[model samples]
Target: MTVYSSNVTRGLMLAAAFTAVVSRSSLRDLSSVSPIGYRIGFVTPQRLWTSSNSGRGSRPIGQIGQQHNGASWEEISNPKSSKTVKLFKAIHKANKSRRNEIGLTVAEGVRLVADLLSTENEHSKSLVRRVVISDALKQRAESPDGDQYHRELIYRLREADKKSRASRDKANAIIINTGGKDAVQACCGTVTSQGIAALVEIPTYNLDELSSEGEEEGFYLILDGLADPGNVGTICRSAVASGVRAVLLLESSCDPWSPKVVRASMGASFRLPVIEVPGDNALDRISDALKIDPKRIFAATMESSGDAGASKAHFDVDFTARPSAIILGREGEGLRPKIREALSNGRISSVHVPMSDGVESLNAAVCASIICFERCRQFAQKKSDDL
Candidate 1:
């Protein structure tokens, strides 16, 4: 007697299969059936209502009891359900361009959701559109060790629902209890759910907003055509750690929302402004966005001299003087001609890490981390001196 709105395709099938039951049964009784229940009762071909009638004293036709698994639960066992298919596509689709068309990203693992919960801000909680919880994790929630963040996740789910009532499209957050491990694997294809994963709204960002903030003392990290997700993620993590105001990804850079990048970022992406600048006059756009002179920006490179500028040792640059940006180019090719031109003209200074005779260069991420910390060190010293 599960009453699925005609919207649920399976419910339509069930309704079609048992037209006689709908004739006599009350809609209220049929609607009472929990969507999570294993079996639903309906009239047999003989036109008799299902369920035992002898001891029950002729219970109402199509009457259903509350589901044992509890309320507000929908079990998604079919791998082909539209909902399941949509989730699978969002989780597995790795191409950045395609993901942009859909505008949603999958964030898996309990630790990531825990990081979201730690923020305790309404906007952060609202970003979570759905949280998929596996039955195994639900059972484990009864134990001390396995229950970490489980209750908090559930709480956030309720909070989302509560906020949804107050605002339009603010919180579409749903807590899905996929009643089996196989179902969880199907959703994420992971050996384990780590308890839960969320499909969150990847927050939108613009360069102007990033540039406007901390104008007097901003530190912006610009990834110029860098394609490595791990490098991008770690650099973002370091950017936040070293007090950067924002992180900008050039149009050619890897998608910050990719699962690998999001995972490697360790939740720092959510904490900072990570934006994409279109390749058309990209540097010009950045220059226009900033309140300070474009000359404050510096480009990091491997060689002492490029097509344009002569590189200076990292420490020679004065990061503490004003709001500035550090540009890290692709892993091997270094900066493009226009970027190098900016460097050569003294608009964008080139900074390189000092290396031993044998060492050519460090990994892109490592170099970024080193320079970010150096900037942090300078800022720390400046703060101390002012005191």
Candidate 2:
């Protein structure tokens, strides 16, 4: 009887220990759960989750799985193994020559990709080479509760693929699923990716395309040696918004097709005609292309005492009066010597945006935006007067 009692007591003690361990583990797991009920491990870099009120524990909508009809889903566990993934990485780092050789650039984020797909221009729409999406994005797009924009994007992607297969076009955009956020992030240029990106064929345009002979008198934006990709991209956005005829990028300028510039442009690069001008006698080449005298070109310069010619305020110039080109220079260096010489020689006039006494200069992008919008305001006022 003594042995039996001892054995029973030992067994009870073991059971109690097991229960305590289990209870501790349960508490730990419960503590790890977010207030919204989503597991912390499941949260994406994009933080694409919201609280659910249905009492069903919250899960990232993007992580939910549903098969999209007619879409070919492939698992890309390793980025190195996939040629498409490698191509995307390469394009992101490519120089002008390499990018030209590849004839491709990347457009990331949901909005940019959607804009590219939905553009009214058939040529621009056709430029989509491939669409790389995260498995989460694909799943979310298929979910009934997903955003309408995401759903439409997925549908368009499928349609685009189907049309390509039907037409047997070699240039059809392949829809790829990375199977997770990591692989998609591998192909993105941004620090925090949107889990979706598209490879787009770079469109080439010649100087002649910038001509606005038959239409309204138009102005052009000449980016002379603007090295900052962000500034270049922002200028492109402004140029498009202000109805600039085309953006002339000098040889020394940063690659306008670079991912940073494209993102800054906010898809404006896809819409605008961007021409590359030779570094040598770029002004003359621009003059020849527009068939306008050199005097029509205006260089944006800072106010200086040693200036060769008196600079006019941006608003004083009547951009609508004739076919004009506004040349913006590098951030620190301003215009190249030849350009400055042109300003001094009365070949091209110099213009400046007036500023307060303390400020030395505005950011290249900010300056470009201000000047471009001033032209826009002038055009609007002119239109109002005509009415």
lDDT of 2: 0.69
Worst 10 residues of 1 by lDDT: 39-48
* Model 2, residue 325: C-alpha shift (Å): 0.8
Error of 2 at 39 (Å): 50
Candidate with best lDDT: 2
Candidate 1, 149-232: lDDT as tens digits: 766665555555444334433123233444466556655635655756666556655565454654677788889889988999
Candidate 1 regions exceeding 4 Å error are 1-72, 147-172, 189-195, 211-214, 304-309
lDDT of 2 by residue, 182-272 (tens): 7789789999898898877676666654556664476888988999988988888888788877889887898998988888887888787
Please identify model 2 stretches exceeding 4 Å from their true place: 1-71, 172-174, 304-309
Model 1 lDDT vs. the true structure?
Answer: 0.62
What is candidate 1's CA lDDT for residue 382?
88
